[model samples]
Target: MDPMHRMEQLVTELNQHNYQYYTMDQPQISDKEYDLLYDELVTLEQESGMVLPDSPTQRVGGELLKGFTPHRHLSSLWSLDKAQNIEQLRNWNTRVLKLVNDYNTKNPDNPLPEPGYVIELKFDGLTLNLTYTNGELVQASTRGNGTVGEGILAQVRTIKSVPLKIPYTGGTIEVQGEGIMNLSVLNRYNETAAEPLKNARNAAAGALRNLNPKTTAERRLNAYFYNVGYSDDIQFANHQEMMDFLRENRFKVNPSITYFREFDDVMEQLAAIQESRGQLDYLIDGAVIKITDLRTREALGYTDKFPRWAVAYKFEAEETTTVLNSVVWNVGRTGKVTPLARVEPVELAGVTVQNCTLNNVGDIERKNLKFALGTRVFIRRSNDVIPEILGKVTEESDGEEIVFPEQCPACGFPLEQRGAHLFCNNKLACKPQTVARISHFASRDAMDIETFSEKTAIQLYDELNVREPADLYTLQFDDLVKLERFGEKKANNLIAALEQSKDRDLASFLYSLGIPNTGKSTTRMLADHYRDLHAIMNATAEELVELPDVGGIVAESIVTFFADPFTQAAIEKMLNLGVKAQAPEAPAAVVEDSFFSGKTVVLTGTLHQLTREEATQRLEALGAKVSGSVSKKTDLVIAGEKAGSKLTKAHDLGIPTIEDEDELVRLLNQQG
Candidate 1:
């Protein structure tokens, strides 16, 4: 067969596989075989200079939408609180228990009874709202910004599971459902399409959001109705019965639905879901557990957002298989050469994955990984997180002998082994090191140069004699244009980006300085402590380390950076070029005895009273440290409605918990 014919055949097969996997829950080819065909197609297209419009390569990402328009939801849509572990689930139980106890105590004569809980798989997909009038589907909308959603009724009508008309003759009712494409369906759809979908969620989201309804219908999108948002003359006794009614009416309900009579039973059900998650045809990150009694639910009520009665207990990522093609070493900005595995692509959770980090040399040796090409390996995204190689050599053989390089690939310098890391000592001279360092300095968390990307930084270094980040401010428009692909229009854009970067706040600038271990939060702490760049530079290592979140390593890096005369001179040059390296004034004085004053708080679950941003602000204003996740260092877990895994973890770790919005408000009032 000719190359062109072979290429065409490959594309057709891959597209078919994608469609089958993504749109329909069926797959005909192994992941390894699929990857081989995909890689071949990519190579052929690159070599032949022929491009297909509907190709799988288009799914990585595309140009950002110009702007989003207001989309009023047919019913109010809300987000669920996430519980990532067993501990969070337990905390949620505890909170519910407290609420029940409190209510029972208050109304002793007409006391509410403990309610059973319903557990269902929380599909990791887009939330959609469907409106019905007189039992007929009228409109469908994406959950855009809660209050408004994009009108996609036409697109929604195409989904098989989404009924165009209700089966029951009923009054006006609003339905909430998860618009999802199964992994098998997504893969099959991608295989059959001109281009494969990136992931099931993205595929479903993109399809639902498409301008044409016919295109969405062709993808065979499906929905699992979960909730009755609003209803008149159609009431259910509990959430479980409501789901049953929905299923009885031919609405697709998540099959994993189970009922637990006790909190321990809920935990057991959650465990069962986690164990069976991998075996299921569809993807589910967590289990949604809700109170099964409607009367109890009414008493529990709601906060600003989310029902107080429900929580999602998320399962961490599970381990699976793939073929390791090769191991590549990467040098980070910190001069650590880390081992990365390039693997045959496989779908984990909902994402199509190919590469994962192997950590360091010790990790590789510890696992006794067979460094042979095409070795099957166990792979898992940590907590359904960033891809990582767990172990290797499923079927052992005389594997290809693998060895770490003694010299840096980017710069031919002798590599030094420290602990598990291989480092290039020639940090100043190495092109990759320089580019990476400069890129780090310009990152949003770092100095935050708005338009400076790794690619652009590489271009400047290679073509314009731009080595250090400081050299960026020194470049003239004429010199920028001299670089390959740097036309007049592009040059002007770069200059504009550079100009805008000068006015960034002190904390961002400090973080951008590429100090070791000084992330955005730490940088802010240091900035607040010193109040000026000069003070930070002059502070002793001990003084620097005394600040919140700053450690010995970070302090040492800051001291070293300031101690270097060359670095100081570079800063002077930057200052001369009009870079404002000063910290912004602190916000208005917070109440000294505010509710969260001096508390180290960890927020977990869905908050009704405030947004995450608002909660963080409120905590910070009251002299509290609000962390992203739960840890031993956390003083309190301010759990709102539907608290998840973090709450459970906090409970196991013996952390104090506050229940309800009113309780939290009262705590704040007392502190004040």
Candidate 2:
């Protein structure tokens, strides 16, 4: 048999198998049989070096891309207005009725038919705009600002459910759909992942936008086409007709789309969808209600940002009332005490919620949660994250009051009030504080001492009298081997790790010190500005405040931290023990004319093109002060794939954001 012909045959057979399994939820061949055919295709393509573009082998991810290119959408993908409740939905229906009646009154001779509605699940995933030219999938992009999007064709090709070739050889067409990670697939992937993805929506979006197509393939994403956004040779009287056309062309159309002639029937269907939402394998935040009649939709037309003929019926955010059983205070590495509330175990967002954060004693008073014990409190899981106590169900609570601790819970030391929080001054004597500090010092972001955990710290503290970070360098190998569970090999490895940590950079060493209210970004800034460790230690609060993004509080914290006699003594001992906190090389001259100059910037999420350190370095060199969190003071935010709370906060604060990775790269590469 001819190699090319054989390859073609295998490709067709494999594609059919994929469609049957992924789209139809049925398998025509066993896994072993499919693998045999796939292997043959791979071998033929490799030997002949004449791989077809639509080959099933092409679905295997290709090389890493430099950055995304801008793709102008054929037709705009408009945002949908949301209806929170049935009343809002009814109001929308009334508006639709008025529009249809007005259009008929204007054209009395050719009266429009009665409006019907089509309800489809609004999937909680990344929106995809797929462009097909002559029945071959030519381009795929994200719905960026509706009119234009970032091209992600290579990553989109990895989704096996999406057909590479369709039966219709029309001039051009754009299909709109969602790229989702199935809940089952996500669970399976997370079981083996080093850092498990927390949310399915974020996982799918991050994978599709990833620079490496191989990562997209590994995620095993799925897509369901719903709308034919653009086409040159296609016209339909209704959404059902358009859907039928999509199915005929072998696009994976979702089966959940339903049509109804009455508005009341649409309302009932929304209730049913919300009820059965938990049973679905994928996530849906809402159900979309659109007029089924094409003429009615055309006559109603669009608003500035949304279609007047369609609205999304959003499900309420997950919230419930649960009894607050008790509140407990816990000490952290910084010796600050925080309140943790224990509530009756209740289900929220498909997870058991029993623990919630009270933030501090100040928050308890503000929310009236100080007297919330033994009473029901309203808890909400915002954005599918950790549940928080909004407030007590009733304003007047007869329950017991949560007493503020006068002594440190971990060490029985008398606690001192510092503004809204209480702190233990006996830093070295406090057991929990000492253990946590040691664990943090050896953390990956700090000194990066491998295999050193909090459990190890407790064991050392109990047996070896190790109380501080400087005490680590004084440990002997013989002493470690004698401890329980410390074999000769393990002891040797720990010693080697500790020895290697001595050469960590100044930024890391500063972070390992666990300075109050200071994070990695602040440490890096200080290290870059001062250059010398001694210079930073001797710097004044006024001088520190002159740097960008450094407020009076942070300046005072730094000055006071260095002024401590204990801290100075610890530093001296560590230095005497040959712990060389090496400074970074001299930085480039600050660029005053760049866009980032004089701006306070925040970097969030995982950036594929540049490491967080690299981004911070570049920003600082361009005269930008990189911050750890989003605030009103933030001038710009550079968000990458899977950005979460910080990104949301930035938007909520109305701060400008740069979400396009390609644009970020361009800005980063610009010269002064």
Candidate 3:
């Protein structure tokens, strides 16, 4: 096939899949299949020396520029005046109508017609202005400081959802839109990350501002174009018609947008969106209602900051004021100490909020938050979100200033300070630590203990003198019954779970050990090298350092953990309790000379016909080092459907890549 023909076919297929997975939430092709096609296109482009302007290969992320260059809009972009409620919205309409009536009286001969409103969901995201010349996407900029914005044309191109060329053939056009992160994608990203992101707004902002096009591509950021900023030769009678024209030309229009003949219709739509906010995949903080008639909008004119033709009905502030009664310290897994503020029960947003996070010591000091026996404070929650403390009391009182404890509240041991964090020194003796560790040990990724739960472990710990995880094996039915929540049946079930954990593979058992800086991936690496817990414990630091992916810090942490007498005792006890800690039979070896041999492979996105574990095992058999994330040393990334930011990084680094499982297989087979 000709390069142009092939390019067109590839783009169509890729765009179709993008719409399926991103917009429609239904993906037809497996990630691996999509990658196969993508890789072919990339290879063809390189071999033929033909780079199509709209090729997907052209969009890869790179480092952010030293700074953003400002670009002024041809037509001034304006903000919208805010209305919080129905009455406020009605008042705005009335005020606008009165102005229109006054302007008509001055003319006397021609009276303005009743204006229609264009109501659309006000997407909670960063606003972007896109300029297209002769149907080619030209300039993309952020709404920086209102007047001018940082130019992000390079970054914007990487976003697959942002069309490189508009569907229309010819026009000089400017469109207003929101660059947003879909809620589902945001949640999925958070779930896979070591530290989950705070919210969608921040994620979207971070993605858009990224200097690398590859990074933007991984984020799967989507755009919805709403308004025509400046256009010539295209005439629309109303705002609705303009939106229809944009949509017809393959521009993504906000699906929640509604045309209202009467103000009551606008109010109804707004109410519907508000009530169904949770059902929608993206966050909508409010609704934007505008005069639909283009002539009416022009007559309404502008304010200094906002367009007089439109009003944003902001969601009512879901915040309430309350008093801070006390602040308490809580310990978490990984041993980070956090402070929680206990405030008087106050209705905020839609729920009653009694507590808010104080984060770390820095937050407390910065807020200068004083929670004596009783202190006045304010709390705010919007859209069923977690309530936050807005501020604290203005007046000073006789109550003592709250101090962070120097010792673990649960174990009464002195704490260790590392950077900004304070941690309990009692690694095993701390009740919270013990419970958390045991729970982690029995998690599906760790020991795979089918029946053990945190609740059951806590019950055994507090009531039955089950001080350590090893003690779980000795638990009796009567001992469980002595606890408040557990009955005879539950006790037996827990014992069964303990028995099942004994047969888990060495890697999971090692992970279940809960050594500092040791996670599931690292645990697997150690197991693959040493074969058993006994071998790992007996291995010297030098021997441990030789393992793939085990760095100096990780090696040191492992050595420290094994050298500890308490940890040694715990392991001895666990062995005595009949917990098996040995690797299963290694998979049949693939050809040693395969490209995967000794090379680090990072897998992202959904794989077809192979589970993640299966793929990892296959790569390991070929002597490859399979890893969880992309780093400087990653040799190849096997990208699949909805492949993330790591895939983009791999491309930017010019790393060798395989698009699909079949291609991966073929490469290995070639080496064989």
lDDT per residue for candidate 2 within 1-672, as digits (tens), equals 988888888888888898877766557788899999999888898899999888888887999999999999999999999998899999999998888888889999988888888999999899999999999999999999999999999999999889899888968999999999987698688656755565678789999999999999999999998999999978999998999988887777877788898888998989877765655667788899998888888888999999998999988646678999999999998889998889999988667999987777766776667777999988756554466676777778679999999999998999998777889888979999999999999999899898899999999999999999899999999999999999999999999999999999999999999887788878877887788889999999989999876899999999999999999999989989988887878987999999899999999988999888888889888989888877666899999987766775575346789999889889988977
Candidate 3, residue 296: how far the Cα is off, in Å: 14
Question: Per-residue lDDT tens digits of candidate 3, residues 33-88?
Answer: 99999998888888888877767677776555776778887777787899877898
What TM-score fits each model?
A: 0.51, 0.55, 0.54
lDDT of candidate model 2 versus the reference? 0.87
Prediction 1 global C-alpha lDDT: 0.74
For lDDT, the strongest prediction is 2
Better candidate number, 1 or 2, judged by TM-score: 2
Q: Give candidate 1 regions above 4 Å deviation.
A: 1-117, 120-317, 370-374, 383-385, 393-398, 481-490, 586-588, 602-618, 632-672
Q: Ten-residue segment with the worst summed lDDT in candidate 1?
A: 58-67
Query: Model 3 segments beyond 4 Å from truth?
Result: 1-226, 232-324, 333-335, 344-350, 366-400, 476-488, 538-552, 590-672
Q: How many backbone clashes does candidate 1 have?
A: 50
lDDT of 1 by residue, 1-672 (tens): 677887778766776676445333345688899899889888988998885543554333343333344567645676677787788877877888899899999999988777788887888778888877876676778888888887776667667556554567677877888998876576567444654454566678888787755567667777788898878778887887788778665576655577878788878877766754654545577888889899888898877877788887766655577888888888777677888888899887657888887777766665556455577877766334467675564435456755888999778789999886789888777888888989988887666676678998888888878887789899899998887877899889888888888997788788777776667677777776778888888889888777766778878988998898877887878888999888766766776777677778987767776775467666787788887667656788988765656665575446778867778766655636
Model 3 scores worst on lDDT over the 10 consecutive residues at 364-373
- Go through the candidates in order and give the C-alpha RMSD of each one to the true structure: 24.4, 23.2, 12.6
Q: In terms of TM-score, how similar is model 1 to the real structure?
A: 0.51
lDDT ranking of the models = 2, 3, 1
